[model samples]
Target: MDAKGSKARNKGVVACERVREEQHRYHEQDPQMQRVLEENYDYMVKHLDPVMSQAIEKVLLYQPDQAADFLAQYFRGTLEVKNYHYVEFQRQQYYDRKVRHLLALAMNSAVKDRPDDVRLYFADFFDARTKFY
Candidate 1:
């Protein structure tokens, strides 16, 4: 990477340090401002730092002709994978809740000495896509 681009990349680190310093200075003087700054810092650390550092490092190393489009595609693919996993997690949670609810209903029926209700629940459970037992 050229010197200018390297310096530009390094500026984020410098600005981050400066923000921390300011945060400390204004810790008691302006609590609300401090909170806002701290939240921004945390967000940058969580969301921006890793992906940005890796993307910048890759771009610098490969020096692609269409750097903007390369970065855009990288971010898009990453976001899609993240979304897919998130959806999968939601579905798993829903399935787990449904299974637990059914199991609870079966237990309740058994406690009430209702064999038919218990049998119905077991039948539904067995027909589910996947079974825990």
Candidate 2:
């Protein structure tokens, strides 16, 4: 990975770890904070763009076992949201970089385990992108 990709991946791992920790703490706390967290999570889920969600779903379904990898990629892709200095260009670059990274990771794993499915997965990703954009 390049410097940027490495940094992005690290950020993603940190974010996931934080989220998990926060969720655990919230569960241990009173019901109020838990309710608030649930509300916020629900709102975020409800507002997600349908096309983007579908694309992610397609990628996840392509290899269910790689869901964690995909989530890591998606998290890395959106990590710029935590940066106060993030600009539109930077956000776009991050998004593209993450998507490509995620795809390549998945493709490589598929090629290693089931080489014949690599082409099918690529075709599925291509078809999904048409709808994603």
Q: Which one is best on TM-score?
A: 1
Q: Which residues of candidate 1, in runs, are more than 4 Å off? A: 1-29, 78-133
The per-candidate count of clashes, in order, stands at 0, 0
lDDT of 2: 0.48
The C-alpha lDDT values of all candidates are 0.47, 0.48
Index of the highest-lDDT prediction: 2
Give the Å shift of residue 5 in candidate 2.
0.2
lDDT of 2 by residue, 74-113 (tens): 4334312232222233434544644556555544444344
Error of 1 at 106 (Å): 53
Error of 1 at 27 (Å): 9.8
Off by over 4 Å in 2: 30-133
